[model samples]
Target: MTRKIIAMAATVICVLGGFTASASSVAQDNPTVKEVKLRAEFYQNELDLLLDKARRGNFADFYQDVVKFAHYGEKYPQYLLGVMLLKGDGVQQDIGQGLVWIRLALEQKNTEWQKVYDSITAKLTKEQLDALEPMYETYKARFGVQAQKMSCNNEKMEASNIRIHQCRKTLVLKEFYSVYEYN
Candidate 1:
């Protein structure tokens, strides 16, 4: 299972090269449905892998997968990671950490993700709530930077395209941005 997750993640990296948008683009702004679809096409397989792992209580690999997925702006794994941490499934049970992960998932623009955050909020204590705020601020800053790592504008890309790729690269990301902004 671990091998499968690693392999799928590697596949995502390979296919990401062909995506029209860069992760950096998504990081700078909200991802369009098209950009999200492009990413989902690349990510779904891996997401399935992680979901299976989480379902079976495979915490260690699931945790690693969640970290990788979090870097990609995926909220599903973040939600699952919250569950795992809350239950101490693979990692130590830590509600504070779980809430932080859930909040991060909710911030990523998924209404479904927000449901999990709301459910958590309904159950937390004042102490947990207190711990969650500062942790959320820290996560927001870090997530903003890491969210773009899932896009295609990393070291693998040609240096020449770095500045100009957003324009010349497939209308995928820019097109996504242009179209997405309207909605």
Candidate 2:
């Protein structure tokens, strides 16, 4: 009786395995599945080619490919291309354009890339800094007055009649006069 039960169980298991294998084969023949598999294959092929170029230190080829990938508006590719440009590893050194791309990457709010963005910004020029003024103004205008206000508040204790906020974000005050005194 035990041998009969074991044989029955083996038969059931084989039947279930055969059904699963046939079902998977049918699914694989579905047009949608075929299309998805084809697209995945193409994507992987392109990725592999790009990685191979990068590994070979063929930066110019990799850079151009990256630009093409970036033009597709892929955020990670844009960030990588910007980093390459900033470092002058492959493409021409264009800090301004690199900052633009890095800013675009940051605008996606990808916190993972924030360190790269910050590192690139640290090496930016005065001109690049000036160029971001419009972006700051736009953000302030869109986000409201509170966003524009410097992020500092201090209790006043006057030393020699001057009240200092000591905020790092504040512009250097060329001249300071109270509103009442100025008026």
Best model number under TM-score: 1
Give lDDT for model 1: 0.51
How well does candidate 2 match the true structure in TM-score terms?
0.42
lDDT per residue as tens, model 2, 1-183:
223323442343344332111122112221221101114345446756876776676677677777654443344556676666555666765444554566654544555466655644454456556765554333223222232122344435566664533221222243321110000
Model 1, 1-183: lDDT tens per residue?
A: 333433432343344322222232223333333323344344567768887876787577667778766545555676677666555667865556666777776644455556555654654456546645665655555453243333323232465543321111123453321111111
How does residue 170 of candidate 2 score in lDDT? Answer: 23
True lDDT of residue 168, candidate 2: 17
lDDT of each: 0.51, 0.45
Worst lDDT 10-window in candidate 2: 174-183
Which segments of candidate 2 are over 4 A away from where they belong?
1-40, 55-57, 107-112, 122-127, 130-183
